[model samples]
Target chain A: MHDSAQDDVTTMTFEAFADTILPGEKRFPGDVTVAGVAVGGGAVASGAVAVLRTDEGGMAPALDNLAEALNGHAGGYAAERGLSLDPAVPPFVALSFADRTELVARLTAPTHPERDIWVSVAMFSTIAFDAAAHLHTVDALADGHPGMTTMGFKPPEADGLWRFPEFSYGRQLARPHPDTTPSGSPA
Target chain B: MTAIESTDVVVVGSGFGGAITAYHLAAGGARVVVLERGPWLTGQDFDQDFKFGSSSTRAFDFTIGDGMSVLAGNCVGGGSVVYFAAMPRAPRFVFERHGSIGRRMWPAAISRDTLEPWYDRVAEALPVTRQDWSDVPYAGGLWAAACHHAGRTANPVPVAIDNERCVNCNWMMSGCRFDAKRSLLLNYLPAAIAHGARIRPLHEAQRLERSDDGGYRLHYTVVDDVDYRVEVGGGAIDAKVVVLAAGAGATPVILQRSADTLGPMPAAVGRYFSGNGERLNTAVIDEDRVREVLGLSRSDGVPYEAYQIGKGPCVATWDRLDGSLPEYLRYSLEQLYFPPGFGTILAQVPDATGPTWFGAEKKELLRHWKSWLTIFTMSEDDNEGVFGPPPPTGNAVRVSQQMLGRGALRYRPTENTLRGWAASDAEVRDILERDGLARVMPWTNDVVGAYTVHPLASCRIGDDPATSALDDRHELRGHPGIFVTDGSAVPGALTVNPAMTIAALAERAVPAIVEAARQRGVAVRYGAPAPDGATAARDAVLPLVAGRAGR
Candidate 1:
């Protein structure tokens, strides 16, 4: 885990986070393999609980990390940043922020490609969800920090989230949901 | 177990204004509840296919903007979801109106200085860019030509989109065929949602009632569009503040409902209304120039293929002739509007009625696609015909709106508009002739027609309560915690797209609202104080390009 101020996420044991935060009970599926987690039926999710089920074995650690992440988000200052694929908030998970982002490093490493990517993506999505409920708008983090644009870093994508069809293209262009056309182009 | 409802700000009509306001307010730590009357559409749902466009039908939702009344979007992303995505700043005269909101306009609204930061913020976010100087029927070149012909440099239009994805599909108004336009649906709204704001779509704000504790009450309905599987039912929301950003037409309507509950609108509430009457004129170029310049090939052009014009097609052709537009006026310009290079082989087929004339046009004898350039003209509407004194017998309540505090006062059109000063017809005609293009038929008569979908001034901002409705800052004169920041607050029209102006103004107004809320002793929850040093430096030192004078 990074420093408390840097990243509040703790390395939780996956089982605990799922058992406590995610409601439905299930075992890690014994099928499918990636870096190496069976994909079949071990994970269980219905609504908000699904987010909890993303990280399988590290369940408790995931919960602790998510909790610490939530604690870091004081109010609506930042949103839960996560990958573009997470589900909408279902009002549970006790989140304060709304921002989301999918951190690819956690659930699936580049070396471990899995056929059922949803499983891993889903796991990371919960991290973002839990984070979002706790975080503020990214601007909150941006405060006092050097603006990326001024520092020659490219501006953030226009739309932070992916609109359904072009969600895959989010990082490629300025907010895939919004087209790159100057106004007056047809939808 | 009763319905849990609260609000820092209650934004009505989630179009450009509402969506933006909600997002910013929520981002700023205010509990914002956005009320949108239309169903939400995501890119996946609104496939960028012509077949989808042909199959899907949309409805008319209107909004008022600087000096004009225009169509508005109603989805969660607000107007950006369905906007043309152009971000031209409001014309100079628009910012300095003489009568209502001009001199007395809110101090924060527009100043080379005040708008500097905001414009930078919005422009960067939308990537509002200059026209591809090379595109045929080139709007940039044409404007330059017209300006040279008129003594004004061509006013380059600032667009709020990623130009790379502009498929030149000619379906801008139909919706981005490609998700290229950086509309709020794809930008601000998502960010706001990410920032904790709650958006309730398909929720039409029917009334604004006052709760027993004097908090605000909003009653809205969840409507269902039978065509779409979307269901909407937003019960009632009680909030601390109410922001009316329903654009031009609907702002007055929402206030009308408030009038029933809050009392007679402040003296200037719904007084001055204007529709920046926008009319289009054009020159049909030799099919070759249209294709070559626009980078489109006519032969390979799809039948009935559309072309791109500046601030291209958002409004319908206005012929004011008491009948449908004559054919030459309707399709001629549309056919010739695209430049020559895109799919050039098909675009310049030379036969208006060729077998390849696309879709049903083949059977209908439609003049196939050609390339042309258009001159879009926006003029002020009649104030008397539009803006009038508040009616005597409307539902009058007791607003106690006694010009209570210092805010925007007057609600009148800008000086230039009031004087009916616009680019001369002779100048326009001269530009047409100089360009070697002729106004083909019926359109010739329609050039003089005053029409537009962008409406403005239904509620002009001013400082004195007696003379205007709200003060310049758009804070309604008497209504505590009530503000109007969207198009409804703009007094006049600009030569460019108004959405950007509205969004930028909203950006400026946001901090003021936040500060004011704090001053009024309202509880603010911005989470732990944004750390002391580095992060604060970043936020404080934003992209501030100070003086971007309007051309």
Candidate 2:
């Protein structure tokens, strides 16, 4: 188990990593974990950390190690570029948005030995923002998930079913089978 | 160890192959026992969420191999429970086509003409129907329109779904929550159960050994339904006949493991694998282009908006298998729709001016998520892939514990396959660009490798035991009572969804299996009457023609 201070750094590092992929505003005032770079809710705001912590995510056990690796990679990246690092916060969290993006690109490059791990992290981050993989579908829609809302997903009707009587092509291409019942099943 | 149970025939899966075979055999008065490795689930247990975890009844199971990733269903109803329900028959050429080795991949006995009766049998059981134009979802409509612009014809692919119950929720692949789709759970399994075929879900078949009574003994493990954790000791069953329908990825592993006790399997046990040239690509249509395609006038006063892709069934294929195109170039492009959650995970649209995966450009792409059209392409390819023991290093999934190591699939697309994909991609680009497009993106690349839901012909059936695991009669070579009748038995790529073809092959092979069971004094009957609604469903889809002509 990680100490509380180290855990906080890991959380901050993950937040920075997710925000770089799908950047968003800070969750609250004095929230240094999230980089307030973009306009709307991004992966961080969409519960990236919470998603990663889920048992189904399969990354909860490796959170600290991944954060440490990110920081180590960030350190090497900074040294190679002769760039100064911020003393405050973790190395990955301290880097500028542009530098963070470049570092991620390098990590996820085709020939990278650990590319699959980084790619998985990136996919999970994206999944959090897109599918809300950690949440129940109906509950997420009821709570107005930012990602689902942004994507303009159609919600279920009052009876919790989707019924589209309108034809997509504006005209019918063929008639329904004679055996088709009023309820849409073949009799 | 638990006391061994006895049955007349033991079927080792619950997918279309196993379920159909069980239904027929049980109806013929044979005591059938179906041992499914996954859990028995219903509509109430279904969800639209993308489940990637290892669950006993997850809608789909993914096995990452050496050069490809395989997607398969993991439930009582098997692939039928999770597939899109498109039931197109393999064209005549698919059966007659020769491989690069100058030999026909499929046996001369198997052809569209020969399989048509069995295909008709499955169609009726599943009650296959062609989607009416009114039922075509917006994404399908857009695809048809694009095909029309490209001087090609797009038709509604024949499917095994009830048109009325489907609400166009676009959750077909995740398993239908409304029980709208005509999965085997809705038809064959229930009929098999009614005929006294006992289905044992969560029973994972481990190995096969010859029983003392000149029958077969199937060793299996009973797993927890929730997490699929194995229990202690496991169990075994004795049967006069054992039918291996555990799918291409799994059946081969089982046979390979049984080799130690049952004697060495033929060399062709895990050869001739094919992904059916499956590829996923997407094209995002511009908003203005979308309105023009929909023929919206300025005076209509409605703001122009792109169609909601997730408002209908998963696929409506644009047929390009006509004789005009070369065999290598012939392919079908099915319009695909993913539910919003799964769709967003596939939102990586490459752009020349910006980062492909992240940044403002990606966010913008997400905003128009409804406008993006996903195309699932399938074409003819050489069945050159081989399933074998995993390498000493690298990533691979152990499909079965008996595999010793991971069940590795070594496949690199042949030059012909590469040309086919290129030709298909070029056609898609031309079609979409002519109408105007933001970006056309393919899901597979160097890093991701190839992904296929239709993995077929790992243990193919042919006339020669040197080149095929099973005889033309669907029996394992040199193993009289053991049979393979699943995607594994399909001799080559079908150039379409393999479900109907796999089911048809099983249907055709059942009579011979029944005769063998009868000769072994299992008191089996043959030519059992079709279950209720079988004739009606068959008559609805069959027009006495093979392939898409009936559709």
Candidate 3:
């Protein structure tokens, strides 16, 4: 396990990175990780850090390294623009949202040798905000995952399975197969 | 190693190719054992999560190469377990067309007419169903309507699915939890099991060698499905006949590994690869136009409307195989829907109006996420791809034990393929923008180096050993009992999804395999006889071609 202080810096850096990709409102008072540049819930609120920490995300071990690299880029970006980063937060978190976005563009540029790594980081952020990918569909729906809820995803029935007897076209254009049963299985 | 086990036949992989072959051979009364490197995941185990890479339990393996990345399912039912279930047959021209060398890519013995009976057999088992107009999901309907407005037809494809049971969850690629999708697990595999074939999940085949008694010895290891960690237990299985159905991305590696002990493999072990010219594009439908098409009035107080792309089957393809395009340039357009989480990944729309891939504009686009349509295009690409030793520079995943130290795929689109892609892109953009119904966006600016799930023809079948890994009989040249029956054996791009064609080829090869086993003094009983009228239909279509001289 990483030291708590180091972990905090890494978490803040990722939170800021995810925020640049998909911004959201601040979680609560005194929350310094999220930039809160945009309106509705975003990658931070959608559990981007939690998703990244999961074993399935395969990003946990690389978090520290990624944060260091991001901060290095942020420092370079700040130096190139003749702007000083805030001393209170991690280097990446200290930059303005616009600066962060521009730095990310450079990191994800097609010609960059490490483009795939940065792209993967951005993708994980989007996955958290879009699908709550780490959570089970039922559990995510029940918990009202910000992304799923915002997308208006329908919840499953009590049996934990979705069954839509009604057609999306308002009316059925073809009859069900002769072997189809009431439960929808082929008899 | 544990004591060596003996079986009449040992099959690698449990996908469409392996499952079909196992079922036929096991039914024929041959003692069969199937070794699958991935776990046996059922409907209960499936979820909408986009589990990818080697770490995921679903084992969606990714082999990132220099110019192309290949995705293949590493599970019991193989590609069929995770496929979209589209079962369209290859057009006749795929077999008839000649390559740039002026030589026909496919063997003369293998053609649509010859494979019709085998295709029919697979269709009956899976019970392929063509979706009715009512059965078409919203995304498919939108595509059809767009095509109609553009004076083209978007037809519902025949799919290997029980449509009645489908809840339109749009999770077909992730494996259907509803058991609605007719994957090989639902049919061929169960049948194979019932016929007494032993399916050993998490058993990875490492190497192959000839046994002292003229049979083949398959060396394998027990692996943990989650991390693919090789466990302590391992043994060799000796069998009279060995079938390599480990998919296009894998079969070549296995053969390459066996070359030293089994004798030097043919030069064409990993040549003529194809990604099936697969490309993904997106179109954002205009909300007002969407409402107009759905007949919704302005008075309706719905602030944000959903297109319900996630509530239907994965794809409803638009057939563009008309003769307006040259034979090599024929392609099909499929309106695909990824589930919520996975769908947003496609949000990287290359040419969005403002602030592409981030910020307020991207968030706004996410707000209307339901209105986005992902269009997947598949064309008949020139098989210019090759699978060889990993290049020194690129990041390559270790896919097999001894592929001369990790196999890597290198591919670049030929001139014809690029033209086909451009034409298809223009057509899709035109259809989407008909009367300004939607804003079109290319998925990626890098069209030549795109990823594909449909990696094919790595160990293609042909008449010449110099250019083909397997002969027309699906057997490796100079190695009679070793056969490759999978997407690896397909000669060229099928111009449609290759699952059905792969299954059909496996079906066609089974009888020959059984006969050969018998001739080799191995007592093999034939089972799962051809469907009634299949033989007569095949006979009427064309006489069975005699074995060519190359063998």
Candidate 4:
């Protein structure tokens, strides 16, 4: 899928980057529907990415830059590790989950130029994941956003004001806890 | 630039300092206008959802122009909106220290006796209260128990809250949606508004210039958005008297920008910045385990059981520092509470381990988010920071980096302050470990150069014009009509939350401010003066408290 503003190549690269950061066991539940389109709970969280790109433009350029530099990152990692590559240039988006993880770890090493790129990706991915899990309501059970069920995170609602009738609200000076028994004093 | 609006007095903040100043000045019959850089938020604006709540009400959204971060309130009420409603006065010893024989007449010229009346007045208005230990949450009880086990006397910390509305949600940092907190938004501001004080929110004062009319001209831009994008029309306000109450971090920047017009200020203008020796520590105590240690037999006592997180006042401090300092530099402890999501974030990174939120490890931490507790320690700190114009680079990112880089390179914690923090941490560690409550975790960030939410003492008030920014009257040493009434004017570290103290100083500064404006042919009258202006000045000051200039 692609928009006129964003090409298909950049979109796919972003999705791959997000999946590596948050590989949900299941799709997030899609409780939210826009224009009758049920949103959230997908293996590839395009909604999260779109929201993140809209909110934080600082990370948007890195998405495309990372895609363009993926081959360089793979080659440098291979050379540093003294490993030979099966293909001289591997497609990062098409790499297996294990290969992608290895590629990412190397790209984000302290000395690597792509470290900031990975940081931007990780930050956006988490924000998108949280938004999907917390915002959706309708297709929640069927949708596979693992963060919701696994972490037991719930969306906020108007539950009414919290009431503490027992509290005195400092009408008078409060004495210390009666249960406070000094270390050397009698229990 | 739009035409400048003229007024009798223009206060540059709306927190405790500005709010109190505006109320008193307005009551004194002067036309008072207050400019706040942040939004004017209402109770309905605050949310419990972490992201929404923080962005809307809790977060200050300011960086220290360095990598080091600072936490302050960015709403209409300022720090009072987000601070733990605790309102303990500065210890009598602090006032006496400046008046004592060895360092007599060196630091602050004011004494405790002069401030005692204003303290009582402020306490009555805010109506500070000490909570019954039974009313606090599980965290409070745990802190009390730790204090007892450590052989330190634990007393109930006083809070300024509306008992009728407080639910004790423990989300005080996020702003009180219930309007339980007696912040300036609820009290002083509204009173000032009723007395003809006009508050202009989202108006950030960028610089100041001496006016042709001899009053100060405050140049400011309206912040259409918090991110500094999309600016509206900019304007200036010409006031007979200008008071700087933008807190410690920002007040110095305002003054620095105005130096060309206001003439060279004392070298001490940006010097003496401090963090009030603030430090925070935490431990994850299993509810069942802690209860059992306290000899409470629950119906279903199980180890590692999670308890439902509820809200209450966030902090309860102990007055005595125990052995945290060498009989002089005092330390105090306050229990800190966070929103559940903050708890999750805190749990995710135990020791800055890289990315623990991917697989089962994430689930394990999120499951027990309710079991975490944070203990914060604050000690007296030396004034040790400087703020000036961002380098010529004009890049916001680069400026922040340079500020933090320079701050890191220049800052060296004094031996006494270091020993104070070390002693405070040891005391907290002893409390947690002695009872075997839970694992005491190491700090995720550097403890020595840890960033602080409480920064004070940038432009302190003193008798000497050469060494201090302001005179004993809280007026700028060289500039007569300009004044400072916020934490920037605080002479030294109070070693405690400085909200109440700031308000008390504002109360004390109002009389001189009104008199100064009146002398300039500005009739500064309270709503309607009592039979006697001097006596009325003594009573409520209606807002100003006039006192002996120097001790």
TM-score for all predictions?
Answer: 0.56, 0.89, 0.88, 0.78
Judged by TM-score relative to the true structure, which candidate is superior, 1 or 4? 4
TM-score of 2: 0.89
lDDT of 1 by residue, B1-551 (tens): 56858776788867666766676567656777888765666665553221111112232332222223234454556567656665655433344444433343434345544664566556655556654443322333433433344333332345665656664444455456467777676766777777787877667676677777666788776666432222345577887778887666556666765777877777656666555534444444444433343332323452112223333532211111111321111110111222211111111112333212111121111122232344455544333214332222111111111100111112333444433323323345554454443332112211111234456666766555665576766777767677787777765544345677777776656555655555544555221111111233224323331221000
Question: What are the per-residue Cα lDDT tens digits for candidate 4 across A27-115?
Answer: 43531111111122322442446634552234454556666676566566567766665452235554555556667656655455555
Q: What DockQ would candidate 2 receive versus the native complex?
A: 0.31
Q: In model 3, which runs have C-alpha deviations exceeding 4 angstroms?
A: A29-32, A170-187, B48-59, B229-232, B293-319, B341-343, B350-355, B358-360, B388-407, B445-449, B525-527, B530-551
Order candidates by TM-score, high to low: 2, 3, 4, 1
Candidate 2 displacement at residue B394 in angstroms: 18
Against the hidden true structure, what lDDT does model 4 obtain? 0.58
| lDDT by candidate, in order shown | 0.42, 0.72, 0.72, 0.58
Candidate 4 wrongly placed segments (more than 4 Å): A1-51, A54-78, A83-187, B52-59, B64-67, B95-106, B111-113, B225-228, B296-324, B327-329, B340-363, B391-416, B446-449, B464-467, B525-551
iRMSD of all candidate structures: 23.1, 6.8, 7.6, 9.3
State the lDDT of candidate 3 residue by residue for A1-187, as single tens digits. 6499888889999999898888888889877767777777888898888878876556777888889998888888899999987888898999988788888878877678887677778777887887676677678778877876776766776877665454344323223323332222221
Q: For residues B1-551, could you state the per-residue lDDT of candidate 3 as single tens digits?
A: 35789999999999988998998788777889999977888887786553333123364565656467677777889988777788777766677766544688788898877777777677777867666666766666666666665666556677887877887766666677889888888887887888799999878787799999999999887865554533656788999999999888878878777877899887777778888887767777786775565332222433114355333333333345643556666777877765554335545554555347665567766766666777888887778888776232111344322110123777877888778788888888888877767887655533114667788888889987778888898998888899999998988777677888999899888877887777666666444643322343334323342341111
* DockQ values of all predictions: 0.01, 0.31, 0.26, 0.14
TM-score of chain A of 4: 0.55
- Which candidate, 1 or 4, would have the higher lDDT against the true structure? 4
